[model samples]
Target: MMRTIMAIVAAGLAAVAVQAAGPGFDPRALKAVAGPPNEVMVLGTPHLSGWPKDFDAKALGPLIDRLAAWKPQSIAVESLSGLQCDALRRAPFRYAETVETYCWDATPARQATGLDVPAATAEVERRLAAWPERPTASDRRHMAALFLAAEDQGSALVQWLRLDGADRHAGDGLDTVLVARLETLRQRRNEEFLIAAPLAARLGLERLEPMDDHSADRPYRNAEEEKAAGAAIMKAWDNAATARRKAADAALQSGIKTGAGVLALYRAYNAPEQAQTIYDSDFGAALKEPSPERFGRGYAGYWEVRNLRMAANIRDVFAAAPGQRMLVIVGASHKFYLQAYLDMMHDVRLVDTDAVLR
Candidate 1:
């Protein structure tokens, strides 16, 4: 009986070994050569204030320099792709608005590529349809240029990547094309001008990836309840943290000309205390929306939907290749949730912003 038991155990071990070696797999060899695990650092940031705040784009230079020093392979931002030209062709009405939005301010692309929105849209569709297995740098340049004309920076971004890694250079027409669109781009209301896009340019990255999801906007079931709940929440925010938060933001914006000032704000913004206090005070506090119970829960649910979607998008960046460093620059309110969901991922290792700030 003992001999039979030993035999069965040995057989099980052999089966396991065989499974591990299936189809040219080499467990030890693969492990030895595998690159480092993917690392992500989510930088919690205040969205640049518009209007009377006098958000000087040049003030963010120090902050941009620090991020460029981090040397990430790809940078993902909170934006979306442009040309779903393929999908739009199949269902024009469904995507008519998208084309219109991209086309509305696509003057820079028209000036550069001489293609209007409809013309640029057709070119994107045509190019993508006949995309080659290996696109030449010239081929990529034209496609990237065309996507820019269509105002699909996200789609234009992918075309930019099609070039050889070393061939991605600034003022190559595609990279520099958006430079001319800077003033016009600011009206779009994003932090891209302040940090993300400029940092990408400095780092010689092909394009920025937008990972924000808005598919599940406002999940609250009761409108009357939601309105009341929103009011209560706003009152709490205004009553408690409004003055202090605004002061800090003002100071940071004013002093960002220096690296020391930027680093101080960076460290403070990413502090655990700040995250905990905000979560406990704002998102955690419950009040009457429709019913006291339902409103808070609904708000939390919507927050979860947004963060989970954002987290999934970040994860997708590392799906094809691990060991890539990604930095997610999002609203400070989103930092804790993004970190929480991303931490749960098996292959994801969250880099300590505290260390980087130091």
Candidate 2:
């Protein structure tokens, strides 16, 4: 018994020594040792689609103006890329629900441009490679059509919005049907359409990056498991922190009828304190729930995997051009996770959202 105890104590000391040594490499220590590091600003937002029907899109002007003033060379929105959607489409067994919920049908654009997702994606790259500094109306129209064909509606809308009012018509691969679709997208109540696409157009950016990842979505093994997991998570969320967050959101959203109100709402969403609030209310609660199947832990693990992949996607935008500024607009719950994941990169410098909102 004494020998076994000694062995256990020795093992504990070895574990401590390993923990103290770490992985022997720290990316944060590099800290822009090579050149100018990339600057990233993450803006946490409530889903505009959930707002009251009376909510005016114009209320976003002040918020947009402030983001525009920051002058991010690239804007990333919480949207899955067409390529990933295509992959998910092929494997419906694992991702049928995800594809149904998040992916759009590109068949119309495919028919208009005679290009599938992959071909259209390549065509978009080819056109941009030799795109003129001063492109014609026809050029914008053609590019918009290509973006639609690529299943990148956000970028397509950016191209469409960039065109003059008279120039937004059916031509250059954009059929009458496609033109109408663009017009419909223009009036949609989505943040990607109202905020990111418009901001990209205003900033003269050619495209908006869709960096959201749903590949980590785990389909439940059965209806029983799904129901139980849902119940567990909902029960976990019925806590004081979640209540406080809901109240705070209600207060902010109540004043979202004007530009200043919108700015204030955004400021509150991106405040430093929000990070802890979000974690405590959602993931943290989920992490501590007592479920035999560990449903809460599964939910928390999925959240982390999704955020890590999203951070990787955002980081990829600056791989070719390291020093550029990037603006990432995503749901409020994701803001803290994204920032925490991104802050670990060797060449990433996180910008304070409060400073920009101020």
- Cα lDDT tens digits, model 1, 34-135, are 668888999998665542354455656666777777777877776544433333434544445544442335567777777876688787778767887767
Evaluate model 2: give its TM-score.
Answer: 0.97
Error of 1 at 272 (Å): 2.3
**Per-residue lDDT of 1-358 in model 2, one digit per residue for the tens?**
9999999999999999988886778787778557677999999999988999888999999999999999999999999999999999998889999998999898999999999999999999999999999999999999999999888999999999999999999999999999999999898989999999999999999999999999999699999999999999999999999999999889988899999999999999999998889889899999999999999999999999999999999999889678899999999999999998889898898999999999
* Overall lDDT per candidate, in order of appearance: 0.67, 0.93
lDDT of 1: 0.67
Off by over 4 Å in 1: 1-34, 51-54, 83-144, 149-151, 154-183, 186-189, 218-226, 236-254, 257-259, 286-293
Task: Assess the local accuracy of residue 71 in candidate 1 as a C-alpha lDDT between 0 and 100.
Answer: 77
User: What are the models' TM-scores?
Assistant: 0.65, 0.97
